[model samples]
Target: MSEKRPVMTWLTDMDGVLVREEDAIPGAAEFLRRLTESGCKFLVLTNNSIYTPRDLRARLAESGLDVPEENIWTSALATAQFLSDQRPRGSAYVVGEAGMTTALHEVGYVLTRSRPDYVVLGETRTYSFEAITTAIQLIVNGARFIATNPDSTGPSPAGPLPATGSVAALITRATGVEPYFVGKPNPLMMRNALNRIDAHSETTVMIGDRMDTDVVSGMEAGLRTVLVLTGSTTRDQVERFPYRPTRVVDSVADLVDDIVPPPPTESE
Candidate 1:
């Protein structure tokens, strides 16, 4: 294997790598702290677009993680960035929560139900039949389609509930128009994130817990990928995938020391 360049930036998934079931995973705090102290740019990424970065930062705080709002990135933000680049100040018929709406609004997008430029779908606690019907009708009427992520289901105390991708599928079935997904597993998301931090892919590392979404996306984005066995993907399951991550560790804890800054030189 060729030698890897020194890492200057990091992108990590939220749930599996940092926390599980609303609780902080062991060593996650230290890893974040070390990353901050080392002065490396980082972002805590999540596919869930139901909550804004502030909300997510608060939730992480409740979980004993001190992540800043600016350090949190969601599919909503990625979607907003993508849309802004695609069509500056374009309007969309948005179907999501504050996270989605707020992101679009920040990018000067006007959200309306009447003759929108695009039908933007995102994650929400509740999926309204009326809204979905409107989205379907709008797509049939010639509006473009877009989605925050392709996650089919989301976790809950009750069980797995339908997510953006599931609803997007329903709209697709109704309108025969497939929505573009802009989240993980989509290199567009990674590229946007890299742009956000002004980091180069060759000197950046992506730490994630899922092979299909996180690892594959990072690899496709030209960054080193590290698989943590704390969430969706497991050790034995690694072999099942056609591709592999740059490394696999138990959790983010194993990576804390690797990011610690070097001691000052005697001349200094």
Candidate 2:
């Protein structure tokens, strides 16, 4: 039998694992502090691409978690990188915000208000019929279709609200072409995070709340999976699903305590 691999690095989800909307989940900051002090490398992997890494850092700081910008990775960054590597630099019709647009622009993709080389979708609070029509036109005109993530709803303090996937679905229904996904459950985002951390599947663990995306993606990447009940997923949901995580925890706090001990002694 092959030997089991040990997890040396962690890729964690943001919304439920650490915070619930704008509020920090219980013990989130302390959990992160413990992980950092224990010398374990971790990266905040989020499917939301509405914000850049720096923007997320600021938001996290506001929520009482001091995450460094370099430690944060978003689907926007991954999607932009993927497009830059796969397609030629040209104008792109974006249905997202400044973050998604900014990332693409940084990667040499030009933004166009009309016909474009591609049509990219992400979370947009201002998703209007006009925006959907524009994207459909671009796709109908031969522009490549791509989406940051396929999350149908985004978590909020009250509940979930319409998100990128819903917008992507609209475009799909209108254009009769499905957008290529580039976020959780897809290898692109995971691969980008792994490359950034200089780690591989065997030594990495993907921690998140959703089994369909986070757990499935980690398993596909050959990385360990840890599911937390702090987000969209629940224990009942896990029981009904065929996919399973290597471990389940209440939150990141439990994970940190499990991987890092309090102290060591010389006696033995």
Candidate 3:
């Protein structure tokens, strides 16, 4: 009889769990391979709404990881899906890049400034004052506010750069309207990702480097969570959070043995 795997699906963060600063973490490829051979459904999640799946795949491939486009899940995609479900064929005034805008378009959302139903905010290095002004006015005009993620800063070659959450705060300050954040730390995002792969939370495992967003989200989503110390959070810092991960590892490299191989049948 084969050793039954404990988990049937996996959800992992992109930056710390798999790749960090454009380099694949040790054993990330092997972990992915193991999942492939075991036929477990998985999604590599990212809160950054700047890159599309194809873009992310290319970037990962450069880092020696072979994640398929479909395996990648972005906050932009989640935001678009949420909006589409909330209001089919809705209109929005968007402040984001191609990733966010294209996702919205794919979901049949019309981008307009004239009486839009939503003011959707997403990450972009190129935050335009004109666009921000437009979005603020739109939200004040009874337009619902939505944001891709609440990540305040993103890693960059030159250090931290302002991300969606910071920009969302600026808008909130100007309009007194807080946007509905649609990324990690929100159990809805986890549930939506699980639904995408037809996976049950009880049978899935979530891996990440952050305690607040990754661990908390997974715990709330009712999945086992793992924290790797390869990215943001540290061992000492973990104790600061009341909620904890299912386990903690040095890095993704330490997870190879976590996937128990199948045993041979008696006939064999």
Candidate 4:
């Protein structure tokens, strides 16, 4: 049970492992190319709920990664799926951008602030006081609260910006209610992604740059995990966490040869 079965699927985090600040990290393109040619089932995961898969794919392509639309998975999608499964065609008081709205719409959710079934909070460039007030009011009145991810801040060109979890905390302090986060570290999100591609945890490897969200979630979901020191988490910071990744490396560049199987021999 210590060693996992051969890797037949992959779940990689988007920001630090593959790209940073909308720029592809060094060796990211080649690693993605290797995944594509290897014919393994994989998805690039992100906590950001601002953009749809198509948008993210285009961004990655611009950064030279060339990831497909289908290969992208986001917290927005997971949140929508969770809501749909919980209550079909439910209404929500959503606070975010097009990505969150589009996902909820696609899943047959009605966006509203009047006695909504849920108060769905996600990441956005501008988190308005008006929107926060509306969200708090809706939740206080009895709507369930759901957040996309728990990461307190997101990487940006200028600096780290307050993200979904940080805003959720404010609302919690106001109303004394907490939100159920549907993104990484939940393990539920990981299970949902695995089911999406018909993947089994024993045969999948999760690659991420942060141990708190990605690695912990993957390990809890029974998938082998790899932590790369290319994102928010540094080598020195890893020991502080109670949980550890199954493997730790400098970056994805070190993982290409380990995860990808060799091509079939010509002699055969």
lDDT of 4 by residue, 92-179 (tens): 9989998899999999999988899999999999999999999998898999999998989877778889999899999999999999
Candidate 2, residue 39: CA error in Å? 2.9
Candidate with top TM-score is 1
Distance (Å) between predicted and true CA of 4, model 1? 1.3
Error of 4 at 233 (Å): 1.8
Q: In model 1, what lDDT does residue 133 have? A: 91
Clashing pairs in 4: none
| Residue 244 error, candidate 2, Å | 0.6
* lDDT minimum window of 10 residues, candidate 4: 256-265
Candidate 4 residue runs with Cα over 4 Å from true position: 1-3, 261-268
Ranking, lDDT, top scorer first = 1, 3, 4, 2
Assess each prediction's global lDDT (C-alpha) against the native. Answer: 0.92, 0.85, 0.90, 0.90
Off by over 4 Å in 2: 1-3, 260-268
Cα displacement (Å) at residue 69, model 1: 1.1
Comparing 1 and 2 on TM-score, the stronger one: 1
Q: Against the true structure, what is each candidate's TM-score?
A: 0.96, 0.91, 0.94, 0.94
Tell me the lDDT of candidate 3.
0.90
